[model samples]
Target chain A: MTAVVTGDLPVIEAPRSRRSGGGNGTNFEMYAWIFMRMSGLLLVFLVLGHLFIMLLLDGGVQRINFGFVAGRWASPFWRTWDLAQLWLAQLHGTNGLRVIINDYAERDGTRFWLKMLLYTSSFLVLLLGTLVIFTFDPDITG
Target chain B: MQAPAGTLYRGREGMWSWVAHRVTGVLIFFFLFAHVLDTALVRVSPDSYNRIMDTYKTPLVNLMEVGLVGAVLFHALNGLRVMAIDFWEKGTRYQKQMTWAVLTVFVAVMVPATYRMVAHTFAELFGSTT
Candidate 1:
């Protein structure tokens, strides 16, 4: 039987409510937490740059009609940027919601259902978004 | 024994920081939701896409853009602070200092960005020669 002690501090076991089972050895939550911060930092730039260009440039939001979008998507650079933004934002928001659900939902069933809904919707949005970004056809006619 | 409910939160910077982070996170989520739908419009005809976007060209929306910038900036800086706390052993001890540093950087970044966003929008709407 190995001990749970670390240095001089008392060995505190993981909480029963924690789905992560930290005391059992998995570090999934730790990695998720780290991903949140890393993705958040990158999103700061990708999202801000997107907002600046789309909402505050020469013509501003007024100029962002179909033609403008079509013209922009014609370049692979914008497509990649948009795709990255879509994935990051969806994953970040979904994971945040998952954490909140785990923290707040008192019952196991409720928490499971809430996360199910969150995951389903997140998946749908990501799939739809990826499709739109890559399969956009600029020359479609009536 | 617990402090009274009214005074429970007194002198707690971490509590306020937690609140701010959650608020910003929610705000960003909603914005992204709408943004994805709007950008998906590009898959449709340009005319249809532009027609929808035409409504966004207003002073009110421009003001909201400033708010979005504030939320994003705060969330990003605080998120870095969170990372520090997670990875650095001394992070917990200096959390308050880190919070202040985050706020300082937020102000530094937002002030200029806000000025540019609002000023440029005003120039566009009212046609400033300068």
Candidate 2:
């Protein structure tokens, strides 16, 4: 197979995983791109439903309190719904920022640090959020 | 190193749209951070959660909510536009059209929502007894 060259500069193509950044042995960028699309679609429903229920529905924000939340969490449906929302939104938005940092940050050190921070914070939030959703006890009388 | 200049405004609609998408995306992400943190307060204590939420009921916070809604709606619609561009064969050729379509939908959805959100705040501030 012949290589096609379009630009003046000589081009050398590397392995997809290598070129895509310090990823594990996988087509991570392709998966990341696909994840963005899929998660964005899911997030539209999850987020809109959340906003509608939390801010725009019957009694609206005025009705939200600890009891309201405890009641909602009492149901498995809302627990799962909120869990999905937190995971999907956090992952999707974090990946978007990763792409942005990749595009804009000029230096390798800067990119590395930025991603380290991003991944660290994203992990913490996701962990904290998931734990909170599942382990919340409404009847802790004190 | 060359200093960055102000030619960002001169980019095509696609570039500008991408810029706006990135901006809105970042805004939503930060908001989500705060949102989750506040929501997590429910686990900590009911009074703390309710107190934090009550602060969000102010007119100032309500106005910010309108802005948040605009950001989220625009990001969602434009995200679809971006997905099309990435996945569809013909998407690149008609990106401008897709962007315009996104903007149209954004305005259509956001206007009524903004009106309702803001109007409710105004009504609450002025009292329903008037």
Best candidate (score: TM-score): 2
Per residue, candidate 2 scores C-alpha lDDT tens digits across B1-130 of 3333343224678888988999999999999999889988877777889899898888899888888888888888888888888889998888889989999998888877776676667888889752
Off by over 4 Å in 2: A1-25, B1-10
lDDT of 1 by residue, A1-142 (tens): 3334334554455766544433557778878987888788788789879877875677566566777778898999999999999999899998988887888899999999989988888888898899999899989653
For residues A27-110, write the lDDT of model 2, one tens digit per residue: 888898889899999998989888877777765676788899999999999999999999999999999899999999999999
Candidate 1 residues lying further than 4 Å off, grouped into runs, are A1-27, B4-11, B120-130
- Residue-level error in angstroms, candidate 1, position B117: 2.2
True-structure lDDT of candidate 2: 0.85
Q: Assess the local accuracy of residue A47 in candidate 2 as a C-alpha lDDT between 0 and 100.
A: 92
For model 1 chain A, the run of ten residues with the poorest summed lDDT: A1-10
Per-candidate interface C-alpha RMSD?
Answer: 8.9, 7.5
Residue range B1-130, candidate 1, lDDT tens digits: 3433333235687779888988888788878778777777777766667766765666888788789888987887888888788789999888889999999998887887777777756786789975
**Which predicted model would earn the best lDDT?**
2
